[model samples]
Target: MRAMEPDRHSYISGVLVMEKTKLLYQQMYSGKVFTWIHLMPIFCSSMVRAQIQTNSDSKNLVTHKPTPTSEALSGVTVEPTRKSRSDSERPESLSKDLFTMSNLSVSDPELEKPANGSYSDVYEKYVLPCIAEFLGTAFFIFNGCASVTENTEGTGHLQPALAHGLALGIAVAIFARVSGGHMNPAVSLGAALIGGLNIFLLIPYWAAQLCGGMVGAALAKAITSDVKFFNATGAAFKSIERDEQVGSAIVAEVVMTAYLVMTVCMGTINKKSTTTLAPLCIGLSVTVGILAGGSVSGGCMNPARALGSALVANYWDYHWVYWVGPITGSLIVGLLLRVFIGDQKIRVLMT
Candidate 1:
């Protein structure tokens, strides 16, 4: 038989008696015999009761263990008896305890929250999402710009189209949970219009996207040779050569951006049309835009991407086309959604 285990009450009593005896022993050594005599009876009785409780607990454990034949016949495995522990001491509570200790508040429906929250809420709500957006956009711009500068012959538009498309798709997929994967300002605008994004977050999201673009463009410049950078105009828009082409280029930008944003709205935001392949569809939309409009307007559907390269190249020629065209396209999509195509909850008309 296993050794006897102590029960809670008797174990507590034993602790008290041990403390009392420790103090009595010191007093007895110090010529305080009367103090020891008074404590001895209480301490001995507590020890006897503790022994009895431990024996009873041991008997319970022995009785609870199933016999081998009974376990086999029932086809069930019997787990060993364990000492009862508080919720905090259980394995399942470890992560919750860690979250509490680290000051990261997890959303618990049953738990009451304070009206005025602490810094952790702000960090989770705003700071982290912006950082994700920044990193995602930066990586996207770096890949697209680097591919443009490389400009391997015979590849023509294929390289840049695939580069930008694939980069955007991957970036969106990675950051979607945190920041909704809006690597483009046009897409962000569309999302805001469709109620996919908060209106207040537009400014901060735009700022982070622009900053990420700049960093990504800078990184692309650093990795490529100066000659290549100059040859490609630092991946800036150089297709529109004549004044007359400005209108055509703007139309091209508007059409292509609208196409991309429309795909984003339908694939990612519209509940009825949304699918798990949203990231893939969105990427393909960019690919198609670049393939179709590459020669006309450089297919720069994202203002942040355009601004990054323009800043690095010092090329402001028709730079406004990049911003105005995409923004106009986004506005058109927003109007269309409100009037016709948006989901039921967000749609304003025909409800």
Candidate 2:
């Protein structure tokens, strides 16, 4: 009986050790998965941004003062020519690039008319822009949602706010030349209304942005543990606690999104306000919105972002708040810009 008792105890100890080993293995595996998911988007986005900035810098090198010729270097008396006025002394040339599209449209006379059914023209004019939107939105979502999942220490909203802001700024800068950097559907709607984007591209851009959002959220989920993902509610909107709070949540979202879209329109689409720093200004607006409205509505100023996380978490409660609020907010901003705030060239009423 004594020998039998020792064997029984040994069996129990061995089973306990096996269970612990299994648990530890799972935790380590999940941690690795989380780290990869969290870092992949960030690393990729950073690399792309760096490459784009390098190209921009190289291009700007041509604008530098010309090198001295051999005659000048040999101390020949070269006549000094009067320098042109500094940039600040002259009116800033209105930028018409992808990021600054004040009065351009699909049917603008300035744009080259492509032949009917030309696949190459269609690909260059439309498909490439949509692809840029997809990549921009995807990386932005992955970074933002992953940040939310990372906020496990009960810290204030600042962490996710900064994450969203920095991600959006980097994404906008990366894609500004290709797609105008309107990652949000609300921003696209605003741009379309203001003639900064072609009206025909609205639905396509929205679809691309939404699809990107889903992909980003899925990537975020893959990187996080089941517990953290569930706890974060998959980074979906959930601040509204009661039916009465719904009204305030809707209002908060509308106001917050209005601010975001307004910044987009003014900083990127309005010639009077457009600057090289437009992307940074727009990103800061997002950070402000999230910080101010986060407690009331979870600060989801982007419907694409909200929808992506909601789909991942399967949490549908008050889901309409995200869509209705941001769209309405953007609509209001668009109307204001078209009627009053836009430059004289683009305004519909005052112009």
Candidate 3:
């Protein structure tokens, strides 16, 4: 019974050992298969990460590199970005350019050209006539007032007439280069009709002459006030006889002014005569007319000149006759010249 018990225990122990070995073999086989499956995916993931890193490094190199000379040879131009400028910088540059241009214009030697026909050609053509009329009228008023001032003890009709003639002559001569020397409204109107001057200029010239005459009269009054010879109200040397000889004054102004306008037209616009001496001739004509009729009419051939004197002298009695006579005479002479002399010769010569 003891021997049989020993054998049985040995057999049980052997069976238990065999079972443990089989279980260990199964666990080892399953672990090996699982490891094989996981290994491929881990290797693929590592390869992909390395490839991504290499691509990133290549991109960085491209961005950091300077432009190649080969690209330039192929006609590629790489321009740098410009920095933005501020608004405050633009006006300063513009101002500098303007100042430079102004300096050049003012300093140029060509500014003193006379009839050489440079610099303000348009001003010479369109604006000079009116300017002359204004200036001449002013001159006439100043000299006329001086002539008839009550304080000038030696002044008389002949003296005043000579003064008027001299003033008219000088003014015309000075402005002849710039304008044609049309100083009176009647003369301007007549010239426009006879010489084909622009009729549009008449109104402006008349206005300017009138206004300038008024200014000149005011200046003359201011100057005469300082002199002891002037009697403002009484008929000593400064006073004009306002109440005496109304009809005689009217007739004298009409006749004298008419003659003056006619003489101006004949001297200046007549194709048969030379106008180079027109200033002197016209002035002499006015002097003769004044000498003939100055005692009766005050010898005022120009309405503007007469009006200015009258206004300053506070005398408006014979104003209408002066206007009527000069205008009538101008119109009549203009018609006669147009009919007799004609503008054909002048136009042909000019052309």
Candidate 4:
């Protein structure tokens, strides 16, 4: 039996090696699944406050009434009144991805039912809307780009795609009521073309969004790991070197942006109960775009985001592809929706 000792030792070593390999793969899979979830705390501050409160009209936020143990003799009964959607506000706008019916509803309000009613009054009345856009865009850029900063190969678009999709959904859920959650300049322009937004407000939304993107990108650079590698790579969008063509890149961007903008417009058309889940749909559209276009044009539907990263890294490789492709696609889709989709004539405040 002494001669067999070496064989036993070899078998034990092989088993140990197999276990270690399995552990490594498990860790990698977990990282991909939870990457987007972990980024939530990094950029979710302020955007989620008061947005999730179920009772919009309730002055009090406290829900505590009595503990089960403390009220053994006489239990305290607490019944909270729930607020339901009213009829005064029904037909929602096309620019928004989610559904809201209250006067406080920040998604797309009608052209006549501006938060302040008239461009002149918007500055004082709904200035918070601009700030909402700023913060929303910033959060998107910071979290979304964080993944791209690490995914230099572009094949790892899976992580970046998931990050961007989930980030946009959360941002929209929190800020859609205030600013219509137009994180992309392309989205704002399309909404403007469709008469869903004030024609004059488009530029302002663009500026705020762009500024947010720049600040978010800069802040992301400061906080993320491997700054040297990220900076060296410039974190700019590039076509997959092997099979990328200028025409194909343009088409990919145009198609993906079209899908995104179209989903936003159609998702809120008072069609289904799922309208309230517009944020998820819009986010999914972004994910789908990345899946379809990441290899071709970096799947950049937002020019502001592209511009922000380009400025930070001083990298402009095929930068125009982002702007031109998304813009063209958004314009065409907006006009198509206007001509064929029919007027919505939405109400302002919920009853």
Q: Which candidate has the top score in TM-score?
A: 1
**lDDT for every model?**
0.83, 0.80, 0.62, 0.70
lDDT of 2: 0.80
Top candidate, metric lDDT: 1
Q: TM-score each candidate.
A: 0.69, 0.67, 0.58, 0.60
Provide C-alpha RMSD values for all models, in order.
15.9, 29.0, 34.1, 26.5
Residues 28-73, candidate 3: write the lDDT tens digits.
3454322323233323433344345444544564466456788677
What is the TM-score of candidate 3? Answer: 0.58
Sorted by lDDT, highest first, which candidate order results? 1, 2, 4, 3
Arrange candidates by TM-score, descending: 1, 2, 4, 3
- Name model 4 segments beyond 4 Å from true: 1-126, 151-155, 225-228, 240-244, 269-274, 344-351
- List of clashing residue pairs for candidate 4: 106-177, 107-177
19-68 in candidate 1: lDDT tens per residue?
65546445434543434444444456566766776676667877885667
Q: Runs in model 1 with CA error above 4 Å? A: 1-116
Q: Cα lDDT for residue 62, model 3?
A: 49
Off by over 4 Å in 2: 1-117
lDDT (Cα) of model 1: 0.83
